[model samples]
Target: MRARDLVTDFPTVALDTPVHEAARLLAAQRLPGLIVVDERGLPSTILPGTQVLRLAVPSYCQEDPALARVVDEEHADRFLRSLDGRTVREALPRKPRELPVTDPDATMLEIAALMARTHSPLVAVVDHGRLLGAVTLQVLLDQAVGT
Candidate 1:
């Protein structure tokens, strides 16, 4: 199947958006992640739920002193880890070394190769220089292991 077949055309967030807002969006939609975008309409990075969780802890600690140190240190550590040596353009991956990408006509086999090589959960699907959506490995496995 084509990447577009399982791709999710969801809303994106900007880098400057408050961590709280980003977390709300993910929770409201029950989504795993959001595509973080730059002003030029190009994706900058992928902000996954884990990033939101870390951000939330600090904000939540505001009302409870007990949680303050927890977020400030533990969760703060996670945020730093999420951005570990990452440039503004790096797509977050289970494996951050190589990027997984495909064109409009890429077949399942082509994506599988890239996924194996990059250990990517999601592969960016582009059409004529524009990002359409991402084909995630989880989606493929879900279909293959359908109930």
Candidate 2:
């Protein structure tokens, strides 16, 4: 199947979307990541779930992971509060990774190859620069194993 055939409506977050809201969506939907769109509704970047977690963690904890272990469970639970007053744009890496995109006619192998090469769990399908939908890794895997 081609990208269009596999594409399914998926959640997307805008650059200005509240970080907490994005985190909620990720948790509620159990998504691997979210497609970040521009004001024009075009895919701009992909925000992996790990990046959101990274934003919640303190730099000190990241710098020295052992520091993370020292934090009591009660305080560690509050780590996500760090994302308060933050926007999705702020959660993004300073240098964005290449967006994994494909056209409607792209073959499954082409999509798989792109996913593998980019290490992205989602691929945005664009037609004439407009997002049609997305194909997630789970869907791709299900199709691959013929389950």
Candidate 3:
């Protein structure tokens, strides 16, 4: 099967966007991370769950409980800080900024290798250099389920 069929309508964020909005998306949608996309709507990188933690915790104590407390105590502050106007570009990792891509005709092995090399859970589904969707580990595992 093709990646297009596997894409799971996951959440997205802009690269230059502030760290805050992604946090809210995680809280509201209960997602682990968001796909950071460019202005053209192409994904630039995957913003892992941990980055949001850094933004939530204080510099001295960066623990989950403390961060959760910060959230509880500073909902307004955090909300105001989130993706207020920034794009994903500014926040994208300097390393491996884009998800690995392959033609629709490529085999799952090729895509899997790409994912493995990059250590990314997802591979952006592209066609002729255009963003289409993404394939993730969950989708791959789903096929093996119930068998």
Give the Cα RMSD of candidate 3.
4.4
TM-score of each: 0.59, 0.94, 0.64
lDDT of 2 by residue, 85-135 (tens): 999999888986778999999988999999998788889999997899899
**Which digits, one per residue and each the tens of the lDDT, describe model 1 over residues 1-147?**
777776667677776665556656777977666767778766666666765554434445546767756555556565434434333233333444554557867777787788777554567777776879877777767765773
lDDT score for candidate 1 against the true structure: 0.63
Worst window of 10 by summed lDDT in candidate 1: 83-92
Best by lDDT: 2
lDDT of each candidate versus the true structure: 0.63, 0.91, 0.64
The alpha-carbon deviation from the true structure for residue 27 of candidate 1, after best TM-score superposition, in angstroms, is 0.5
Model 2: residues with Cα > 4 Å off, grouped in runs? none
Error of 1 at 64 (Å): 19
Candidates ranked, most accurate by lDDT first: 2, 3, 1
Give the Å shift of residue 137 in candidate 3: 1.6
Give the top-scoring candidate (TM-score).
2
